[model samples]
Target: MRTLLDLVLPLECAGCGVPGEQWCTGCSRALYVPPVVVRPRVDPGVPCWALGTYSGPRRSGIIALKERGRRSVARPFGRALAEAVGHLRVAGEIDPPELGSLVLVCAPTRARAARARGGDPVLRCARIAAEQLAPETVLVPELLRMSTGVRDSVGLSAGQRQSNVAGRVEVVGVRRSRSDNGGARTGSCTVLLVDDVVTTGATLAESARVLKDFGVPLAGALVVAHA
Candidate 1:
């Protein structure tokens, strides 16, 4: 199924540029380590975990997916997220209620930015992670959204970054857990926020605040990297 363009341009690892593989074994191995608990500048009132610092293969992979449009990298990123969730469950850091589903809510991005980037890479990764953990897990992709006119947080101070996203994140809808047979479940489920990176944790904190206001039960947040 190799196309002519692929044959001419060739496939290169998004993380390390090793030819012939979209994601090389070495780069994929880099993301398989134990998840590290991180304390962000702004706490979201819940445990925050990251795979690693935003460097090396992690940075390259994120850039490839977000800026270069190398969508294939989402598979490895999603698998890493699923593994992290499993680790949290094993360590007792996260516990989904009995007979209820574990919901993965993707941190929202600005619609304009997402449109320019082809789509939301973070949401795509979250969906894949939910699929890998499914039957007991579900994905709520549009549970949150960034309101219009919010500035980017690229070079803002931690406080400034927080101010930028505060009051700008809006919850669109609430999703209740469903059973394996596709029937509605009754008890409360745990909501875990998923994102690509955690810098000052401004966005995550804001997201948790809105979800809390909406009466959603949140367990914690997970990110691919901690900046």
Candidate 2:
């Protein structure tokens, strides 16, 4: 059953602007490849698990969601991200548990970016991943904004990316604590940083630095795509 507007108006594909398909068949085919689990220690201080390379339809999809205001598309993109990093293990993987413990901490986007995009796309994707992995994992939003800057990581080298965001993240707030209302304090918990894409991993590495300083156990990073 189609609505009057749906029938009267045309809908172009998010990826290729093709009519009828939400994502054009050609673009959908470009969204992914067999998932590649890359242990990228590119950020030195922080470890990361990246999925597919940034190119073709995958690149188009990410751009559509980020710059083109396709918030709804993040669901499928997030699903792809989760699948890419789901069974990951190792320092540069899905934040390997020290004694079998897993916690997910989504990276915080800048206020300007959030405002420009209408909402936080990375957080949206991370929330989807959390919902899909609920009950089996402990996912929480424990990271906070420590700086106000933006970096374009499209084609920069690893070292350039590292310098771009150095000393950019800081940890604030203690969750599960009674200090807010004066109740029993549970202290801080371990965290695994989550994001939508990783070019040089500057953001994730900075997050790890903040968590480590705050006494929270630092796990690796998780992402949907790598460029």
Candidate 3:
């Protein structure tokens, strides 16, 4: 992991460019805002909650994780994500996610992109969040796979984004919930999609659609930032 790589690399604050801090407390707090629920106009099953807008320290931190290989920031963001998810409540879900019942699924990064980045930072972040939030809750890293030939959604209009990812994500594995201790957990397994950021909500929507088709419908979604 990148954190292991940090033994040689210096730790720097991703948000404010401060020295000797992977992620400053102030910067972390800046990301701890009220979660915004995102539901695209077309699909509603995949409602998502975002910590804040994609700007400021949050944006800088994400960029640092994805591009600069600053893996230290993932822990704080993971903890922040855990807190946000703890407070998130979706319609028809009265109680908090029961232990071992919730599973966090990372939105699939393109295979090409994953190789380019050395690995998936989003998946790493989601794994940490799931561990910190509930060790009983499983984290499924390979649950979703981007359909072949899917292009990057950047700069595309909302409609285009939706169209681009439509039928472009598929479930490639069996949905199962297992604790960190290697024992299978009880309760039905329901997915909660995790992403680094959400803009038009198309990717998450399409992901939810695919998962639902596989009979693993989403409980909801959690993203670090909303653009």
- Runs in model 3 deviating more than 4 A are 1-10, 40-44, 89-94, 175-187
Error of 3 at 162 (Å): 1.8
lDDT of 3 by residue, 112-227 (tens): 98878778888888878778866565555578888778888788898998888888887776644343322222135556788998878888888888766665657788888888
The residue ranges of model 2 lying beyond 4 angstroms of the native Cα positions read 1-12, 16-18, 23-41, 89-101, 149-160, 175-190
Give one digit per residue, the lDDT tens place, for model 1 in 1-227. Answer: 33343355679988898988988999998997779999999999988999999998999999988887677888899989988888888888887436356788888798899999888999988888887786655755588899997887789999998999989998776453343422223135767999999999999999999877666767899999999
Off by over 4 Å in 1: 1-8, 96-99, 175-187
Q: How much is the lDDT of residue 177 in candidate 2?
A: 49
Deviation (Å) of 65 in candidate 3: 0.8
- TM-score, one value per model: 0.89, 0.71, 0.84
Best by TM-score: 1
Give the lDDT of residue 149 in candidate 2.
66
> Residue 203 in candidate 3 has what lDDT?
85
Count of clashing residue pairs in every prediction? 0, 0, 0
How does model 2 fare in lDDT? 0.62
User: Across residues 1-227, which tens digit of lDDT does each residue of candidate 2 receive?
Assistant: 22343345477666566777656657644543335555555653655555567765567777877887776567666666555445554324444434444556777667687778877777777777666665556565656563676575557777776776677765545553434531211133335677767766666777777666655666567676776
User: Cα deviation of 140 in candidate 2 (Å)?
Assistant: 3.2
